[model samples]
Target: MHETKMKPTINITRLQSTFDVSSSIGTTEKGGLTRLALTKEDVKIRDVFVEWLEEAGLAVKIDDLGNIYGRREGKKKEAGAVMIGSHLDTLPKGGRFDGILGVLSSLEVIRTLNDLNIETDRPIEIVNFTNEEGERFTPPMQGSGVITGNYDKEIIYKLKDKDGISFEQSLIDSGYLGDIKNRSSNVDYFIETHIEQGPFLEENQKDIGIVQGVKGTKRHRVQIKGKSSHSAFPNSHRKEALLAASEIVLTIDEVAKQFEDLSTSIGVFDVTPSVESITTEFVEFTFDARHIDNAIKDQAIRLIKEKINEVSIKRKVEIDFEETWDANGTYFSKEIMKSIEEAVESNGYSHQYITAPALHDAKFMTDITKTAMIFCPSKDGLSHCEEEYTSIEDIEKVTNVLLRTVISLANQN
Candidate 1:
């Protein structure tokens, strides 16, 4: 059984004040934050966060990937520190709570500790990683991907945004360039507080989610090619690409249904022909499939391939598939998982264990440390848009949980 000890109550007022400042940092249309990764808005927000970190009386370090780590040294300088934070970068017209809540809540922890003159046995670090949204860059979790050694630094630098601004150029322009360093053992335990980004918590009226694991994501680009035929020739001999594309779309649903535990989505689709009567010569679509278990994810991928091949052969259309992304699911350590549950129960916040359908940096951090996440409810299940909303009261509750978890880890070690 874990020992029962309580620290001073974290200053909810100050925490809410910080979150409000962050809520307006990169406000976009419809009260959304539009700070994409490595853009001007992203730079402005990162700079503002640096100022907050400095004011909290912590030493800050920026890595080559522009991930910022702020340190509050305790009496034991060499002890492995406890770290907490999330990304500050926002998606295009993203809601304010998606990434900012994790970051600002971490700041609130530092602010509380500094104000109370409470010194733990271990140092505490607040991290604000660059480009967690990966909207400007490609593939979300760019910074954390590099930190966890899942992605190479060179590949990340070469990533380009819509305007063709390279990730390297963005880092240099933002003055975030720093020496590349390995991210390991700087912390013994890591925690991040973020909005649920889904409707599960709010629909259930739960105040928090003790994340069990991040879902594994499989992304594919599928292409279907058939003979362009005359409008009048709509027979089976025509091998119309659009016809085959429709079949493939339906197959996605069929295959997804076969895997009851997984979530599948086909978000992007394009057909070349513009004329209504003309059969499209080429059709392409992207598929994003996710599951918390690798076995189920693998089974889903296999079934999709089998169905695509079968349909292509029957329709006599040329078909091709390429895997654009494969991110594995990540599980949090038992100790950290227990701590999150304890925090939830101690604070009297209704909580449940849920898998995150979206990818997060926490997935990468799991490779290096004992990592977990705390989730607050997203109002109306809105995220990645300007409509994203999470109440300040919920943010405060998660912050209190984050504070208790971090302290519990620090004191135990």
Candidate 2:
């Protein structure tokens, strides 16, 4: 066993200060943040993180994907690290806490350990993944995916944003294009802290949420083609793509309602040549569906496809579906979950084990090591918006639990 000083209490003041500094970057008119990955604002926040990590005496390393890792050496240096962290990017006009909280909380954990002069049997790592929101870049979780081998480095680098700026170029512009190679290294365990992003914890009157697993997500791009015609033309000859697209949307909603546990959303819908006097010639929309159960999620997709086909034939319009991304629901390690439960109970905080409806970087980390997540309550269960909020009191409680959990993992053989 490694010798150590007494355990230190969580410093809420420092935690709040960290959040305030990061949130100030890219501040929007509505008081939200817009720190898209690799943007100038994001680079500023990354610098802040680096400064803090160095101040705490951790050796920082950056991989080719721009994923930042801060390592605190343990007594047994050869043992795999116990990793904890989340992404630092945010959606446009996004709330202050979504991904930011996780990164800062992990840093706080390390700072507390430093204060106590504690060293454990295994090294501890705090990571900040890049491009988690995917708002600026398609397909979120790029950094974690690259490190886990879920995506090819070349493909990710070549990906472009709306302005035709390649991902690789953006990294270079931000001065974060490190020469370090990306590799899926060994990790004894992983934990990510995040806002519930839903109303579960607040509704249940719980202080903390021990996430059991995340829901499976499937995204599709649907395009419907039809002939443009004058509005005065007879309805008998017109192939109305917009009308068919609306029907498809309604059908998806109706089919999704059949399963009480399923969650479905259509976030994008567009009609080309949208004029009052002309029939829409082309329609494109995006479909997103998620469910905790694999069978149910797959069934929902099949039903949606069947409905789309039927609607296409009836409306005499050509419709095509292209799947953009698919990730099956993943459960965490049972042993790691037990440790979290013990930590929560020992910390005297009310808690519940629940499934996460939103996808997170932890989903990808699961491929490499034992992974779990801790969720703090969001006021009104809202996220991805400027109004998103979690009280400092709740944050402090969850951070304490996180600190205890990490310490417990670090000391284990």
Q: Give the Å shift of residue 203 in candidate 2.
A: 1.5
lDDT of model 2 at residue 187?
83
- In the range 1-45, model 2's lDDT, one tens digit per residue, is 332333346899999999899889999999889999999899999
**Candidate 1 ranges with C-alpha deviation above 4 Å:** 1-7, 181-185
Give the per-residue Cα lDDT of candidate 2 at 323.
90
Instruction: Give the Cα error of residue 348 in candidate 1, in Å.
Output: 1.3
Give lDDT for model 2.
0.89
**True-structure Cα RMSD, model 1:** 2.1
Please give me the total number of clashing residue pairs in predicted model 1: 0
Could you give candidate 1's per-residue lDDT for residues 307-341 as a string of tens digits? 88888888889999999999888888789889888
